[model samples]
Target: MNGGDGPSSYARNSAYQRGAIEAAGALLREEIHKRLDLANHTRSSFTIADFGCSSGPNTLLAIDIIIQALLHKFSSSTADVKTPEFQVFLNDLSHSDFNALFALLPPQSQRPYFVAGVPGSFYGNLFPKASLNLAHSSCALNWLSDLPPELTDTTSPAHNRGRIFYTGASAEVAQAYSCQFKKDIKSFLVARSRELAEDGLMALIVPGVPDGFLDSQASTGSEFDLVGSCCWAII
Candidate 1:
């Protein structure tokens, strides 16, 4: 699924969803503050960017929670400090409705100096190397461009019309899906690594199986396992 269609489709399909997305962002911001001591980094400015930031009520709601949490944390510190000026860059595909996102911004808040609608996939480089101090992505990375085509073959009795997991799929199809997923994930990590500063924090939340499963199958799963090992590799 493409970025525009993915979030819009999910927003339309889910009926019982509350403002849980925003709440999750708040929780993540709190975690990052505790981990990074953003308030103590007074000598230099800090920046953050959210990739695959789909435009809608949900996206802005999440950002608002994150910004508010950061502000609250920054305000509570007493140490002599050069208060870090924040640069929040909101990024999504070029086709996204950024006007709607801009209109939703709180009038009193300090707005982002750079508002960009980055075209193409976020699995590619989206920001400059060491440019970002904090990066956040949520519930978006799992949407691959399209399903792998190699798994589909008319002659094969197990083949099922471009799907990896049909009722009669062989082990090979499962392995192919796994391969595609790993490639996508590795691309994601490389792009993110270019954007993050040394000691920078990236809090990514995505739906997935356990990290141990990914680690155990390292030969077949090394690319996918990179997400869990980001801190170890970067730090």
Candidate 2:
């Protein structure tokens, strides 16, 4: 994701992604309320980690929704409930504009949680085992940790020349991308599994394609294809 809040920056260009998060807000709240095990939440603070949190208002919005849902859950409980402090870890690549993200935070007097920036790849462990109560990510899982090896190997059958992505590439090139995606996703799941507390809840807003759909059938594919075309034209 691009850094900063300029017109072309990710923060400004992310309404499409924001809509996906907004659409999933209800489901996220309901699932958290119904399934989060408060019995195991005996600690003084409850931890929530937002993986791939780009510079935002979207990340802030998502966190606010989760906190509100938890607060409502506590208020509705029949037994006396002790609300714990909230700790939010906003994670993204190291180069993400943390300063801009912090600038978007609610004022210190009004903010409900102790928020911190976590910088690193999500494919590796970022926190201690069993530390997170809620793990959340939106519209971010599709990113591969690295490009497929063969995409850069001119001699390989899967080499992806004249294109920046596999959208209209050959089957072998597409297969290479597919294999890399699987590996990256598996690593993500494993790392998150290790970080989440027992009975912890995970909320993800992942984009997907129908079984028979081609890459160009999706909006993102079309956008990338356009970018690639422009790049080739300049070259």
Candidate 3:
């Protein structure tokens, strides 16, 4: 895990930073509520999954918040006539630590919920078709498996066209990296489409430049987009 060297290294190490992880979970909780409202399916069954959930205190913290938020919202009078049981899946690479997460469960909670761990890259399908009701991924997905090779070549004219924020590199290499990111994201979405149910909602928070300066095509490599597309395809 060389965090500074390239994409995989960064993905292995950066995905679990403390503050950013907590913030991401908080934002995801809010986004889940927002999406639920948007879908107008307030009282239906709810199942949530947190993708790329590396082992750590922050991951558990996020899960706690998400569960609490859902419990509060779904149990309210405005919700549907019957309370829905929640099945939460926690997903991450096989190497991720789960001992800590498993140890942190609260005792005897009112909300009827179950937790399962899914091992693999979030890039692939992790659930049954139309099984997930909500999905949240945070501080992840920016890490592509590899940097695009075209960016490494200094002679190409399109080099600079796809480059993102790394200014020290040749422009062509940057463009290649950008293109690779877009392609990767598209594939990610296609895979997620197989698992998300109709009207399912997902919230994703990733690192990016403010003011939308980051290339839209580059940033589009996202778990949120993939899950959303999956939901759309079902409809």
Candidate 4:
């Protein structure tokens, strides 16, 4: 992802991602209201982690939605409840533009939560065991932790000589990418499971090709392939 709020930056180009998160707002609120175990949560603070929270206003928007849903949950409850202070972990790759992300945050006086940046891949352990009350990730899980080793090994059948991505590549190349995705996703789930408190809710807005769907038919795949082609040309 491009850093900063420049014309080509992710912060500027991520309206589609923002729209997806916005469209899911109603369902997210409903799930939080129904499934969030507030009764047993005696903690003074509510911890929320956003995995793959790239530089931006989109991450902020997603956090606001989650916070609003939680507020509504407490407000509508028949039992009197004191709202807990929110602690949000904005996670992304180490090289992500943290400065740009922090710059976009609401001022200290207006902000509702204590924000912190957690820089690392979400495919591994990020938080301590059972620390988070809610874990949310939007339009980020599709990224594999790393490329499949076989894709670069000359002797491997999966060696992708002319392409950088699996789309439009050979079956072996595609399979390698698929396998890596599965492995990364499994690792992500395991790590999150360990970090989330019992009864914690996870909201994921992952975009991917459906089963039986052709990658060639997907705009995202096409876009990546095009980018890969450009990179290949440079090489």
Best by TM-score: 2
| Worst 10 contiguous positions by lDDT, candidate 3 | 1-10
Please, what are the lDDT tens digits per residue for candidate 3 over residues 17-61?
A: 656657666666666566655235554567788887766445565
How high is the lDDT of residue 199 in model 4?
Answer: 76
Of 3 and 4, which scores higher on TM-score? 4
CA-lDDT, candidates in order: 0.63, 0.89, 0.64, 0.90
TM-score of each: 0.70, 0.97, 0.67, 0.96
Residues 52-76 of candidate 2 have per-residue lDDT tens digits of: 9999789999999999998888778
On the 0 to 100 scale, the lDDT of residue 29 in model 1 is: 68
lDDT of 4: 0.90
- Candidate 3 achieves a global lDDT of 0.64
Q: State the TM-score for model 1.
A: 0.70
lDDT of 3 at 7: 44
Decide which is better by TM-score, 1 or 4.
Answer: 4
Best of the candidates, lDDT: 4
Which residue runs does candidate 3 get wrong by more than 4 Å? 1-18, 21-31, 37-45, 107-112, 149-167, 211-235
Query: Runs in model 1 with CA error above 4 Å?
Result: 1-23, 39-44, 108-114, 153-158, 162-168, 209-235
> What's the ranking of the predictions by lDDT, best on top?
4, 2, 3, 1
User: Distance (Å) between predicted and true CA of 60, model 4?
Assistant: 0.3
Each model's total of backbone clashes: 0, 0, 10, 0
Q: Which ten contiguous residues of candidate 2 have the minimum total lDDT?
A: 73-82
Ordered by TM-score, highest first, the candidates read 2, 4, 1, 3
